[model samples]
Target: MRLNLPSVVLFALAVSLCSSPSLFGAEASADEKQADWIQLFNGKDLSGWTPKIRGHEYGENYADTFRVRDGLLVVSYDGYQPSDLMSMDKKGKKGFDKFGHLFYEDTFSHYLLRVEYRFVGEQVENGPGWAIRNNGLMLHGQDPSLMTLNQKFPVSIEVQLLGGNGKDERSTLNLCTPGTNVVLKGNLFEPHCTSSTSKTFHGDQWVTVEVEVRGSEVVRHKVGGDVVLEYSKPQLDPRDPEAKPLIVDGKILLDHGTISIQSESAPTEFRKIELLPLDDK
Candidate 1:
């Protein structure tokens, strides 16, 4: 049957609407475009992340080391117990020395990760001396299965989040190389811990830390809107047994890897963990 020009146009329009709804229907709002920021934590469950702790299996949590409460991700020490003091401190006791890191399930090359965290409650009994309100975000982290059974940390560059004591000047968004190194000021800096220029954030206040990463090229640490630290060329340390094998051509540039949050035997909470893709690579 022969159809009128208007009828033929109407049919084509219907097909196009079904094929591309956004173009034919109402345009996507600005809020929808910004909504591309992916929420890594679901706020109600740990669906896309896994926990790995020293002396435990790769997937095993080793006593609920990480959990979600009140829409916040909490790294707790109530799961670990000392064998020597099992019965002596039955009334009120907490013992945890294991260093655990909660890792994202997937790996990415270049992206922006933003997270908000705060130190809360008290440190677990007999926790490490340096772990008082201590935690970090391990970017370009090795896979949990690759880490040694007793390895305390993975081969990654850390955007260390340090909460300040009530009276001292401490900086957050610091760069820490557990098994990696970076270039700064046109030199190969080899410090294990590099402090950021961020101001001291004291008490149990929420602090937002944003990290910008571009494969093996550059990484920047930001607090709020200000970039506190910037570095380039993440390479593995050849001297470290756990790190040497990861080196590439005597220089291991971290182009793509996992991301993780630390469980340093301190009580900490994370409200938002999100990422934005910068490129296809």
Candidate 2:
């Protein structure tokens, strides 16, 4: 009989996977030729991207949240109003659940993804405190087609991007796992979020973040060409209720998936989104 994993044995397996030396798979040759960068975002339109927003249909661009203006891919909240954000339902829940993601049509496995972004203007009023200047690159994500209408976030690994508040030190390119977990330094890391070593980028200055992903073997986050964080073995967290249905053959290994951008109430802009394939992957 097949057993549902939420048991102690599942926890043990996670630990065992962390200790196994085979977890560190063979590395690619240094001289491997790289392919030319493929631009995922066309500076003119959102042609190849689809919007998935909470409380809306899959293709509904709710309130025009994601748009291209001034030749930049912008996440704007200009269409939202005080009533739109504050209106409540019978359950006392907020009516306008505007969390959104703009996903590229194609999926990727082994590649180096780069994005040039910056936080701008103010966040929508009454936005969550944790989401101020907060946005993310959702990597290895579940297909938007499978997500429920009310699902707030996709099941994926988030490379969180944050802007410094002009004083306190806040690092960009941080890691956030919504329905997943990863191995860090030969141990199973189950945290919801963790910081990188990148320097704080204050104001509306542009910041470039590059993520090198090798299937499910490893993932590295870089800032200014310096690698700030490294981890491996990104798998679906069996304990996550949202991720439970995605488990197959009791296997949680994530070999590849889609990429997307977050619109978590913060106004942000992306000037470039490009990818470089590795070897033949």
TM-scores of all predicted structures: 0.83, 0.85
Candidate models: Cα lDDT each: 0.85, 0.90
Runs with alpha carbons beyond 4 Å of true place in candidate 1: 1-32, 84-96, 248-251
For model 1, residues 92-196, the per-residue Cα lDDT tens digits are 655444788999999988888889999998887777567788999999988888888879899999889899889999999888899888998778989898889
lDDT of 2 at 256: 90
**Candidate 2, poorest ten consecutive residues by summed lDDT:** 25-34
Off by over 4 Å in 2: 1-35, 87-97
Residue by residue across 28-128, what tens digits does model 2's lDDT show? Answer: 44323334778899899998999999888899998899999989999998988787577566688764457899999999999899899999998787787
- Per-prediction CA RMSD (Å): 7.5, 16.1
